[model samples]
Target: MSRLSDMLRTQRFDDYRFYHQSTINQTLHLISAIIFLGCYALLFTDAAIAGIVGWLAMLTRQTGHFFFEPNGYDAVNDVSNDYKEAVKVGYNQTRKIILLLVWGSAPVALYVYPTLFGLFDPPTDRFDFVRHVGTLWLAIGIGGGLARMLQLFATRDLTTGLVWAFKVLTDPFHNIALYWKSPLKLLRGELIDSSIADADWGADEVEEAPHLT
Candidate 1:
């Protein structure tokens, strides 16, 4: 875990240094990709429209990560991202995009399903074009704002402390003591050795092994 720096505007790499690999995040990504693929298949004629939407999203995000928010991993003359600030910026941006995509999954799924099924039936006025527009805009705005906030954290912007403080207040359900203890402990290099989780039989803990593992 990287600690926040105490600076107004630290250099490119002074900011950003906290990390935790979450499988929930990976699952969300897989779901989003599968949803997009579903939409692509619904396009029928090779889904030229859905293809454009995906390509545009990809190009825009890649541009931000590679150029404007380049990771500081190699910037500090280190082997990889040694918990550097630039790398933090890149990661923060990635989170924002993920949030946007997560928000978008529902609407995109709706768009795809009805279309795929409707192919055999009469269409309903070519779909809810307005709702789709709203979803896209909402994803872009929310994602961009969140990404900026995370960038501020990396830069040691004065608002970093306030931002996290507000997050703790608004989303207290996330890091409760008993439930999320595993991930939090892992971050501190404390692995909670649970034989119940490791046991092959004789316990229901086997059902929830991944949560602790």
Candidate 2:
């Protein structure tokens, strides 16, 4: 009982709380979910329209990762009081943005076919448009979904990853479907310490940046 209390009281965890999914960010998630669902529906009805919405949603949804961001430093108050600490935070922020642009943007290009919205229609007679649409969504849901599963590594929380996969499997776009370490890490400034030196103390406990989730 005492150990459990100690664990609960540990300073590593914070008193931080988050609003329900009705909040603006969560609402955006809902909007993205609806769009993806609609895209799926349309993908079957007409490949051209489905491609347009899919690509558009892919662009808009992913682009927002940069526009709607809160510096994560606030989640963990800095006690370092060292001059270098603030500088480190500044450097980290810039790095995070760059990473979001590069590694995180792969899906945008990978799914560009859907994004193009049938600008260059794959010949209907030769190409099975419905097959293409289904393939794209399935790829995003399963293939990209697996990649997103890898992202749980950024959280360093295995259980959290499992739960996240279970929740977002049906809705890929809304889920961020990649382990976006930079954005979430920058938001919270929490990252896994991989230095061999730190391992001497003990294998670090699996930690998560809850705020980003």
Candidate 3:
């Protein structure tokens, strides 16, 4: 139990330090986290609403990654952008791009095909169409995470994959705890987080980032 806890902690730490150096990005994550918690609650009541809210949360989170997070060599962590992506336990930028591309095209495909390549029933109205899209997006969200988890089993190890899956599911709670103060810092004109401590700790966690197969 202790070992599992430690792995979760380390995964969260690595994710934050490596992926969320920008204060703006952290602030967006904070917002996403809050919405994700709400979506979690909604899952028990109205799963359709949960899926819609989940997409909103994901959009906010990815917006920060694509537009705000730093892409240069991480001087604090003494690693390059490529190194971090290669070692990333979960969706790296390349993988994320593919997911996002599919997400972005879903609406278009639905519009053109109406029945979405015969997967969904033809909608009677716009609201039905939107509901269908939301459900499809929901499947994509769940499937993407599961697929990556399985991929990690082959690429890293079974334990690493399971740990990462847990981290991804619990990230809303963790992000809320970690980044709640980020917006305040941004308001005070701090555009980048002072991640020196995180970087130092990360370096100790792994002497060299392992290249994935």
Give per-model TM-scores. 0.30, 0.37, 0.92
Residues 1-213, model 1: lDDT tens digits: 123322212211122112222223222223334444544464575343554454444444334334433334442233254333234433345465675575556456546664434432323564454344434544554455566566556665546534444442222222222124444444565432232123232223122111100
lDDT of model 1 at position 109: 58
Writing each residue's lDDT as its tens digit, candidate 3 over 109-165 gives: 889998977888899998888887877788888999999999989988898899999
- Where is model 3 more than 4 Å wrong at Cα? 198-208
lDDT of 2 by residue, 147-207 (tens): 5456654644554455445544354442333222323443564332112113221122223
lDDT assessment of candidate 2: 0.40
Candidate 2 residue pairs in clash (backbone atoms < 3 Å)? 52-117, 55-115, 72-187, 72-188, 151-179
lDDT of 1: 0.38
> What order do you get sorting by TM-score, best first?
3, 2, 1
Poorest stretch of ten by lDDT in candidate 3: 195-204
What's the number of clashes in each of the models? 4, 5, 0
What local lDDT does model 3 show for residue 140? 84
